[model samples]
Target: MALDEAALETLGLGTMWVRRGAPSGQGVVEDEPALEEPRAAAYETASPAARPAAVQSVEAKPVAREPESQSVSAAPTESAPGDTPVRPVPPETAKTIRIAPAPEPEPLDEPAWDDFEPVPPVGFDPAPASAPAARSADIAALDWEALEARVSNCERCRLCEKRTNTVFGVGDRAGDWMLIGEGPGENEDKQGEPFVGQAGKLLDSMLRALSLARGENVYIANVVKCRPPGNRNPEPDEVAQCEPYLQRQVALVKPKLIIALGRVAAQNLLKTDASISSLRGRVHRYEDVPVIVTYHPAYLLRSLPDKAKAWVDLCLAYDTYRQAIPNDKARS
Candidate 1:
């Protein structure tokens, strides 16, 4: 059956139609060209091979997204033909930074010098050096009183600078038996007396062994009156400067026999650098008086075995004393 306009409109077909195989001019009905379908129009206009691509282009239009941060610029990107163009974001203005300068350091206060007296450096000698030759004559003529006074005020050598007290000879002035040692030690320097320490005690013991005591018939002296710093041996110049005092003592005492204790005493008294071992076991002479050498008490304390040798030296000294004073009966 032939459809009317309402039926054709409802069926979504063209409004007019012709019978099949009818004469071209006999039943021809003219109507406005039917509105073409959108997809069909695109397919008819586009080439058959490009129809799928044309449809895809319309369906997949590219979108231009805004950048997440306003400070950063969007990178340039390519787009398909129908896509929107992307706008670049301008860079944010550079930020300004400020810095502060460091604070200056505080000044320190100066030390107060007026609070205390200044100490002199070690080995500081204030007195001028005097000639030994000029002083020797004056010292030689001084009796015990003047000699001691001179020694007490002596500045002959640098050893005087650090000495606590001058160690003059101790015991009887007129004693027949004289014992000479090296120099004053710390104890002797403080006491201003020689052989008064542990060494002094040992010496007293040794004297008792010989039936003798200090200040009885025994006199004690040292090579150097002043103590060397740290109990060091007296230097050659120190010995030379102090020799006149020792010589004066020897002349006054006129000891029958002299006992030179230790290597320093033996070497300095005899003017020989001979070892104590070589100087021992024999009677040596110093200014016409017999001299005997022995180990120092300080040395014996460290070397207990050598005490026997020191005893032998004491026996030798006693024998020499008896030989010199045949008429004396106190020790006989």
Candidate 2:
């Protein structure tokens, strides 16, 4: 028995089929009537008793159709009673998703270098600097009165701080014998003169032994004009500061011979660190003047034996003086 169009459609076979004797390329059956619309309407309207026996027989024995290997286009379609509706899936496409970059960090506000100032460390206290000493050239150019004035007001070293007076010097300015001693002691500082203590008495006796006296042919001075505190030895810097004054005095006096009394005087005058004992026998020269080393009168007071040595040094000085000035008859 042959199945009609409505029965084939009901069984999901909606595609047209060619008859066995249909033309080869025409794809239509010859002499067949058009049955699509009329058959589909009849299937919908006809009752169970009114339907064709062949259609009813085909419905009772339905044929299953094989699934086609083709892509289906998504389209909306009506559903029959008791059927579930299917949703169409959309085709995949290449999409571009852009992510905003993180915001850049703001620059920090910094202080300028010009606004910074240096800070000194805690508990720091700076000492006041001492005044600069006078230049040698300036001191050399000064005359007697000018040099004395300068020495009176000099503050070139720390020794000036404790001095009661500056012992500039005493005796004849043109004396042929120049006696240089160490710094002043307590009595000399108070009297504003060099060797005015018990040391001064010993020095006077020595001077009389040679037929010389202060303010006569003997000019007296010292390595330093100011007295050291506690009668301690004058420091090297203190001696250096006062050296110009002594040099100027030597220049003005133009002494025939110089007597350096004690280790300090001998060392500084001869510019030697040799001990007084080693220096005693030698004839040293200072600014072209013969220098005789002797123990200081103050030293002689403490050391009585060395007094004899000092007399020998004085005798040597007198001999040297005679050689320098032969005609002058001071003493032997």
Candidate 3:
């Protein structure tokens, strides 16, 4: 029987547990109270706007059974006369439900120290990962002359003060290939062009082996404009500050492929600390362009044994470039 609204409000029970059920068997009679005390109180105290409509309670009672039937676990036998409803004994009297709370999902196995590789530091002075370059999103629409002008006058970091000139990129603005190095070296800083020394000469020869010309078809830039003191690795901060110009240049040039030379360039562009061995010969996407990684020309010079691997990387780059271009346009 459904409880009257007055009886429902008088009890303190909330209506959250209110549900309707049908008879289970022949001897079982379902008794519903006006509302359980807990359910009534819940609804009475609930905000008027949130209260549900028509709350009720349901309980099961067993009628007198056959003499041989001795199941004490069944519902309490019989209901009260008239409007009275039957109530089950408190659950404490009932058997424990044995609800082992899903065994608090075995604490994840702690990774072994050796299994956890160190993360490369995320912050750097001058050029931080926190601040990306500010430039038009579209590279093809950028004004290269204006970009070069800005790079020349850029004082975004202290590197500008240490440099003779901002080794802004030089070569075909419409080039299909882009070369990115760690930053300006002593020779590059002096000449105000990327890759002009022994390493640059090697790079030129490497390009020629693929029939690619430096000033005619390939473009070059560095991660930083100024040389680090004593030719140390350019710190993360330095790259962060100078990357905006490179990002803008890459966007403007829209090269079909980018070759990130050495660890610094690879790490900076990929935001990864993976070893060069792990990175080499693999292709990665830089914006819409395909990026091929190889040993830096300098490193190849130092470790001559790796030059053969560098050649392989170059071949992969050439193949990837060929794949990226339409067959009809591949010759061009």
Best by lDDT: 1
Total clashing pairs for each candidate: 0, 0, 19
What TM-score, to 2 decimals, does candidate 2 have? 0.59
Ten-residue segment with the worst summed lDDT in candidate 2?
22-31
lDDT score for residue 297 of model 2: 88
TM-score of each: 0.59, 0.59, 0.57
Q: For residues 1-332, what per-residue lDDT tens digits would candidate 1 score against the true structure?
A: 11353365576453333223332222222231332244346656788678755444433232232233532333333455665543332223346667777877787776678757678799875544445565787888899999999999999799999999998898889999999999999999999999987999999999999999999988999999999998889999999988998999999888999999999999999999878899999999998899999999999999999999999999999999989897455557
Once model 2 is optimally superposed onto the true structure by TM-score, how far is the C-alpha of residue 215 displaced, in angstroms? 0.6
* Local distance difference test values of all predictions, in order: 0.80, 0.78, 0.73
Better of 2 and 3 by TM-score: 2
Better-scoring candidate (TM-score), 1 or 3: 1
Instruction: Extract clashing residue pairs from model 2.
Output: none
